[model samples]
Target: MSQTTLRRKFAAGLTALATAAGLVVGAPALVGAQATEQGSSASLGSAGSAGSAGSGDAPNTAPAFQPAAGNENPVGFRNWLRPGCSWDPVASWVQLCDVWSPAMNRHIKVQVQPARFGGNAGLYLLDGLRARDDWNAWTRDAQAQRIFLQDNITLVMPVGGQVSFYTDWDRPINLGGNLVEYKYETFLTAELPGYLQQHFGVRTDNNAIAGLSMGGSAAATLAARHRDQFKQVSVFSGYMNPTAPGMYTMIPLAMFDQCKCDPFAMWGLPGSPRWGQNDPLLNADKLRDIPMYITAGSAIPGRYDQPSSLQAVFNTFNGIILEGLSRGSTIAFQNTLNARPNQATFDYRTTGIHGWGYWNDDLIAARSAQILPVMNAQAW
Candidate 1:
């Protein structure tokens, strides 16, 4: 069949699937590309509130920070730490904080949902290319707070990092009119974790990390490079192979077009060691023995989505192209790992798109099947 005919058939199939699944059809909203500019400084304010715990207790008004053991630094945590710029009380058990990131030289927000029953395991959720400064799309769009509220795990969702891929850049990039210094790798693996452990009772080791799209690739790279830090990792609709044919150009183009940021500042030139170091496919061997979950879709629009405008249709088309690239890269990474005895779960759907609906479902499934299991383990 011709390409157009195939797409129509796919859409019809999705419509049937939607009908069978009882999905509510809705106008297509921009999944991860809604935010146009970075966040500006503002005094912290309470955005919303939730119940105290997963069991529906009174909202907990207890202080979130305490001087726990090993928390005190000779330099003092107060020297650079600033908290409570923004708050989202998901429940009596869940709270989000905007903390100043000294490494990135700016304030970044993290959703802080304390683990139920005092569990020490933490889960970090990373966002995609057009990550907003106000909140991670996971919480704002994916209903992630509700998904993990009852679980015995701290949910860490850092806000903002548009087109950053969450990596430690060699130099600052001009984003729109502002020069952004992206040191997300350091903030996540070091500064943020230390803060969580000291103040929130989150454990540094045996943590779980997951991300979608740009964040997904970063999750894999970070988990592999910092194997001692993360016990489990998941990547949904991520570009795993950075050095694949046409990827060097394609990636830069995507980054530049999204936020007017130079991709070269991210990891040096295309053939540099940084690219190889960050490529999850090339570093697949480093992920051995770590429980991982990688998922992607064919980029076909699903039944729950409807293109209501020309911009929506264009955005949907763009998502298709980007997700198709990710699917191909993830499959290649999966095949490379087949050569070795590794523990990884691959979820490649024949139909779907790189939208919030699929990613939300993926997060729920990964948390239940892969993340929680490894986290609840008695030993690593």
Candidate 2:
């Protein structure tokens, strides 16, 4: 089918699905509007508990821990080492000491699944908007530990940042009646990398970043902003163009409804220069040299999903609306990128929703299709 015809059909399909799924409470408005009341907060709940087992049910294979001899530093001394290392028996990877971020003024946990061959190249996995404080969603919900067990690359997953967007916020947002200091861009791009390079043997030149939802946006923005550091990026169901027409308001409303956080504190008031600067579409030129893989579902429920309860049904409906928005935003971003000399591997799926099942699949697809090839080349 022609591109125009395909797009029209996709729109019609989405509208029909939304209406049937009980998403159309009133006259069909913008998907963003329907999404505001339901919001993406559905992700904050226990929707992933059913799928937390992940695709691989393999048992942990990490050997019993033994203390390193003589307190010898892995990559020599570092100043960011405020809170030191520990052993996590559950995942079987050495929990590298959670570092204190001067920017965020909090201790952020960083987990490392050490490369089998002691390879230095790192794959940074970023979490979504409703990031948990205990463990990254990749490990908890997606079983990433089992998936990359044999790979010769360090798996880096940072903990916390519920709605921070993994960016350097202009100011803190009051959420749950608490002010969250969200200098995540500085922590991840600057502070965390330096600490990882010194301690975990992660190399700046060979790292790839990927994220789901909020983290997906962060993966694109961070890679584009620091091309020298990240060589490849993958975004799964992320809103790539934050400065797009409805996004200016839709984003903040979602943030507030989901976490009581204010997006105004994230960048600035809508139409601020920071929004354009941080927008992946507006800064697509900076990502021209980097390999990127982007994917978003058409919001159709897939095989891996079954709504068993009323809450599950509501969650599924909300997910469909959210994924629809992501699909539209990703298409716009991809179209803009295609116009330039640079192009990303875009997987616009015919069926799926915004949840762990699709994000997990996208992660594996990105690894096989884009990340592993580059990392393998670099290894050779």
Candidate 3:
């Protein structure tokens, strides 16, 4: 069939999918994306408020640092330390390493927790739309180091990539008086993985990837595109269909709100093949062999919500709408998977919103239920 015919069929299918998922078409979808970006900075601060035990309730009282065998530094892997990155240890297990990314032409900091008993499996955790340069939210918001301390697997979290969607863009972005290049797909799939294998004893192919919000979709995309490299994928509160009705516009608006970067530069114009190519729903067939853990909330306030405060109320409102949108897209993706022999686990929460607390819950659940087993890593 011709390209135009294929595009029309896809759009029609997307509209049907959205309607089936109970999503009001154009404007509401756009509003959800806008509100998500607007509230991300403030709402993100209330991470780990879920009131759940495993979901960030325990304190990070890991044992004192100890250097691995044959390594000199207190935290292990000193011998393999690259020049640009040094070991910045926070807890007994966590090490913040700054590694160079040639694609972006800058040094990127990665929060790492080496295996406690020396294992080869690794998990790459991704950040959200407003991802900061100094630290990955997985470390700042959630207690990843402590939670995974017993697991004989490395946790690799890369810092930064605000509004970049962790994808390789067609052009450079000028943000805050600096030109930033986003080749995150290249960095994560190729460059960073090489460094991890050499330095952290992680196999490039024996890995799992997880992310929340923007990073969630990115995790799925990266895993699908590089199936040989990533064995398992998990997405928490992610918009899986970028080419769905209103999402093509919604993604760019969110990008502009965060970095004033042009969305066109990231994936050409709306309806371009690149948009569909990057969409997880459109590429669902490619993931049939990969195990996936996908989740989203009802957008209702759960145990984590604090409605008394004004900022909290605003965040609650934004969280509801944002998660509702994420739910629509995620459910649509789930429906797509249902038709095929896809290996996916879907978690549709009865009460929750788009924030770190639920993502922490999802991550913990995924690790125990799917990730560890898929990568053949030991939980304890």
The candidate that wins on lDDT is: 3
lDDT of 3 by residue, 67-178 (tens): 2243223344433444355555545356777778899898888888777556788999998887777778777566676567667788999988877778999898888788
Candidate 3 residues lying further than 4 Å off, grouped into runs, are 1-89
Ordered list by lDDT, greatest first: 3, 2, 1
lDDT of each: 0.67, 0.69, 0.71
Which pairs clash (backbone N, Cα, C closer than 3 Å) in model 3?
none
In the predicted model 1, the residue pairs found to clash are 44-85, 50-91, 51-91, 51-92, 52-92, 52-93
Native-to-model Cα distance after best TM-score fit, residue 24 in candidate 1, in Å: 27
Q: Give the RMSD in angstroms, all C-alphas superposed, for model 1.
A: 11.0
131-174: candidate 1 lDDT, tens digit per residue: 76766767655667667655667788887887788899999988
Shift of residue 164 alpha carbon in model 3, Å = 1.3
Pick by TM-score: which candidate is best? 3
Model 2 misplaced stretches (Cα beyond 4 Å): 1-83, 92-96, 377-380
Better of 1 and 2 by lDDT: 2
Cα RMSDs of all predictions?
11.0, 8.9, 8.0
Quote the positional error of residue 53 for candidate 3 in Å.
22
Q: Which scores higher on TM-score, 1 or 3? A: 3
Judged by whole-model lDDT over C-alpha atoms, candidate 2 comes out at: 0.69
Model 2 lDDT per residue over 1-380, tens place: 34344333433444554454345433233322322222223432223323333312111111222322332223322212233667654454536568889987888888777665567788989987767677787776675666665566778899878777788888877877877688888888888888877776788677999998888888999998888789889998888888876666566655654565555888899999999988898888888778899998887778655766444555566567667778877888888888867747889998987877677777777877988787772222
Please give the lDDT score at residue 252 for candidate 2.
65
